[model samples]
Target: MTPEEAVTTRASRRSPRPRADAARNRDRIVAAARDVFVEHGTEAPLDEIAKRAGIGNATLYRHFADRRSLLRAVVLLIMCRVADHAERAAAETVDSLTALRRFVHDAVDERVGAVCGLLIDGGGQDSAEVAVQCRRVEATCETLMDRARHAGQIRADIGLRDLVISMSQLARPLPGIEYRDADAHRHLDLLLDGLRVPAPAACGAPGGAEERSVTYTEHAA
Candidate 1:
């Protein structure tokens, strides 16, 4: 091939390369930001995320304009995953109570706790994008709560706001507290009992009697 033709061919090949690299860099930044933020909360430094991503700060800023921008991106990414989980839960479970229980169980993990902690710490002083993501999460939770209530899996008296608040509280990981999966399951079982209708009658015995019980115990943290 001629020199000029070779040069032209190389240039054409290189032209799309930077765009691909940029795309990859953006993905790396997002992934790294997610890991860092989840580990250190949203207050994690962008420089740390850049370093973890193996990219320069300038590149990170070029992709995400500011901390808030990066935070919003992370929040949206998490919310999208939550939405997918909700969809899957809805489809797979026949019982709304089971679905709600599964959803809460899935959310009580470290990753969800980190996200919830970040938002709670941020409080009312959040960026517009964060606010939007919050609203989306709220809306999704409301829909799930409504479905659960409609299916008689939740109390009619409990509002979506109350459920949302309860979810946030339950998502918190208490320090010095040894929480086991069985404890979580027990908590969920108690919550479900509170939503249950009157117990059904016993059968197959003449002296059968229903026993109503409510017990509360405190555990050390």
Candidate 2:
């Protein structure tokens, strides 16, 4: 090829530099949206999210087509984060029970339940990306629960659905209570206790006497 033609070809084929600034803007928007949703549910205004991200409404809409689209993005981000946490907990903890318990604590601590409302109906986004991420999160939960059950750390009847529902309900904020209430953690502890297997009685005998057991009969907000 001629020199001029070769130069033209290289120029045409050269990939543009990575849009680092746009990527940073997208990250900021997602982070701001998550914070807003945690504080005010998914109905929080897009303008507020843009303001929080220090971006304009036009830019926000450019990144996300609409409110539902933005909600889907935030939910996807959260599911990915939770899935990573579950993997880390499973790999790092020595016992399956500890890993399972830590996942619940850390996930709730991350306010995953805050986004559960958005996921109530799949966030109204039918994209393949969302579906795949959801499956990964579900698989992690199943593995954790299976490990715990096999180790006799949790009741055999407990399943992923039960764990998720309980965590979602627990993560919800009470009407008149502050988000950082100590009682909330205590109540969560009670819920976790219910999922555990009962310990063997200190005394053993034929037709043995009743064993003292701690039954969590109620969960108070």
Candidate 3:
């Protein structure tokens, strides 16, 4: 090879990645920030985040120059994860309604609803990248909804907004009530059941509330 090509190849090889430990610390900080935000809202102290991450304030500041920057990282991280889950649910699950159902359950368990509520109240999309990730997640959700709707699996009345509001409501922890994942899931199932289109009235019979109350799994069958 020519000397020029050799120098180019060496330069490419010399391009550096972050040190492994530094990268790991940043990830840990992002994760801890997410949990702390969920528990204490976006305005929680940066020191709390550093404490949760088991890192020094200096280290946290080294990774993120300020609270807004750190919050931005947390927001991007959550949205990215949500986007991945949505994409996976769409591609890997054969049955559209089942896929949607699985995605909703997984999202709820992820505390996505809670995180969103917190963000809405105090924080928001801090960067253009966050907005892009938000749209990506929404688009995947829309695709899932459209597929289920087209298949007559979910009700035509419900749309993405309805589903999101339902998720947000279910994700909230009401005052004076103990929070349990099981309870959240059970309520979510109810909402999902409400979103399913009831079977057509048999031979012009009335479509009653009882019919509408059937489990989504049974209706899917």
Specify the highest-lDDT model's number. 3
For each candidate in turn, give its C-alpha RMSD to the true structure in angstroms: 8.8, 7.4, 5.8
Task: State the C-alpha lDDT per candidate.
Answer: 0.62, 0.75, 0.77
Which one wins by lDDT: 1 or 2?
2
lDDT of 1 by residue, 1-221 (tens): 99999999999987755578898999899778877986666778889999999999999999988776676666656655665666666666456665665565555442454566555554223566556655665666667777877876567887766655565555554756776645654554455455544422432223222231221121111
Off by over 4 Å in 3: 1-16, 115-118, 121-126, 199-221
**TM-scores of all models?**
0.60, 0.78, 0.79
lDDT of 2 by residue, 51-106 (tens): 99999999999899988888888888887788888888778646777677667777
Decide which is better by lDDT, 2 or 3. Answer: 3
Q: After best superposition, candidate 2 residue 133: deviation in angstroms?
A: 1.6
Candidate number with the higher TM-score (2 or 3): 3
- Candidate 2 wrongly placed segments (more than 4 Å): 1-18, 120-125, 181-184, 199-221
Off by over 4 Å in 1: 1-18, 54-56, 109-136, 175-221
